[model samples]
Target: MSDDELGSHYTDVPGQRVVAAALRAAYAWSVRDVHRNAAMLEIARMTGVVMEAHGPGRGPVTPLELVGVLRASLGSLLAGVRGRPAELADVVLLDHEGRLTENAYDLVCEHVVPLKDVVGSRPWLPSWTTMHSDQIRQQVFTAMIASTKQDEYVASRRFLVEHPAGDEQELVELKDRAGGVRLAKGGYRDVPEDQLYRAPNGKGWWWPCAECRWPMAVASSGKVRCRYRPHSAVFDLVPGDRPVLRRRDGARRSSPPAGRPAEGAKCVDAGVWRFVVVPGASELRIAAAAEHAGAKVLLWPFLDRFDLLVEAGDEKFSVDVKECLSLSSLIERLRRRRPSARILLPRSCEWQLETLQDALPELAVLTETKFLGQVRSAMRKAR
Candidate 1:
């Protein structure tokens, strides 16, 4: 099959083009004075694509209309747009500030692998700007798998999950431990300015998300939260010589507030955090939960074959955690890559179990709650 045919078999070409174009336009608007001509051209191209898909009379005509439509729910934008499935209609694309919403982030990160092909190379929007997080993840994983020993790869992967953000000194130590394995240069970057909170005393600080332990985004309005909204712990910056996070919501309990000086601090690239750390957090949490329920748990067993292997009494269960914000994207991925073990939805994604089962009726799947119950029962039976 040709490249286009292969891409079409795995992805929605028109839908992905619409999403990539919308993202490029949003990034263009986010910048200051750079790539103005190229941005306009991109917006015009996006307009044409939208018109082609949704009918010239129906979709956005001007840049302002495009921005407005992007800020609305994805379902609303594609309500009558041709070729978009009904399942994705409810996914919100962008926030009021024109930033990609969490659901949109998941959609683009997982489904937009052929991004460069969909929207030909632009001088202004580099591959780094348009590429999905999973692409970077795949590159990094492939490199490690090819170069490092099995133990080395496992240790390196665990370190990334456990410490997504830390001081420069800590990162230096990580490099030293890599023992000559070529960690990708783009794996980490200085934490973005917007993710840091400026204190009243002219210093900036960052707080780790309660769940993932990565630097959270701090808005100009003093709002603090993780880029991955499912982390769900919101806070307000309490500025002082030493800044701190003050919990703003009581709906869910989270870890105690902790802050660190942002100076000389670095974090994994956004794509790495989204594709690696976010799901890794759930994998670790689920493993801990199973252990707490009196089961013996082994993480990433058999050279990273699956997420966790749990032994309760004489029963052994191998599960792969699925924690995605987009049900459609998750379903598509599972269809393409048949899993070797049963699928387990993390706490945040338990709602997807029913839909996933209905879509893949022959696939083995269960929620974290159900899995924990089974673990406890097995432990009792063994006793």
Candidate 2:
């Protein structure tokens, strides 16, 4: 056979010229959205977060599995750097399908990051190898500390053990960290140290760096509580799970229809939009579409998951509950409505009220708590 013909046949043979094309394709398309949501839903369900509301489908997790998440998210993002290396595109992908074993840590250290040849003491961003589960947990920890500088549980037990409750020393440390504390080692911190130090599982973290929310490990009177300070660059230093980014105050304003696109923008990289509507079409739909013709199947099937959906009488509150619930019984309910609908997941519960609106409206959304606050205020006003 000719060179071209022989080459084609050889590649088609399995396990010979094996190219991880599927994995590579996944990498290329792996934007932060779903990959991130998948990791969150996976862990939230597993940890039974906030009283196992995610249901029995998610069981308890061991320490090893926690470490795996830290490594995966970090390693994946870092990709092939000597400090954080991995198998597939750098860092392993962990699916929270079961109650993972702690042994997963041993597996990660041995299999995932086999070579610990640290070339320089440079700080690494939380690479993709950073564990997803751990990353989300850390983000939760970070957000908590960011909002409330004192993580009560961790503080009372860990730091308070040393500083004691009502101790002047603890309060002083807390004051310095709301804007983040300056470590003797280097860098100014931003997170609320008091919040992180008091969290339920808050042990290893040091001063809460607002920018990084990583518990900064500080050694002063000669003690390293969080020995993994430098490595925080490689692991879950902070809760990097991007919930949603809020533009700075005064950044947004009322727009008149098709406000402003940008200074100079290209069609292919619409930069901010998912799909663009062709200008003059009343109801635009792509047929043989342009270069980037893609399709999406949003699984939002509104159904009877709406518990106590008082059509009348009860004027308290109601949820436009989408069918992708966190319970097994809800799964059954979804199946009943499977023929007619799909589940709609907001980027987060925070986006619940706005998810149903026009995606292209260019409007700011409120938090879930904000909606609840409105409900409470309305009740008080009525009373």
Candidate lDDT (C-alpha), each: 0.73, 0.24
Candidate of highest lDDT? 1
Model 2, 305-352: lDDT tens per residue? 221111111243333323111222223233333322122232232333
TM-scores for the candidates: 0.86, 0.19
Q: Compared with the true structure, what per-residue lDDT tens digits does model 1 show for residues 200-295?
A: 677878888878988888876788888787787888777778877777874545544678888889888776787788898998888888898889
Question: Per-residue error at 294 for model 1, in Å?
Answer: 4.7
Span of 10 residues, lowest total lDDT, candidate 1: 1-10
TM-score quality measure for candidate 1: 0.86
Off by over 4 Å in 1: 1-9, 32-45, 55-58, 85-94, 106-113, 121-129, 132-134, 174-182, 250-256
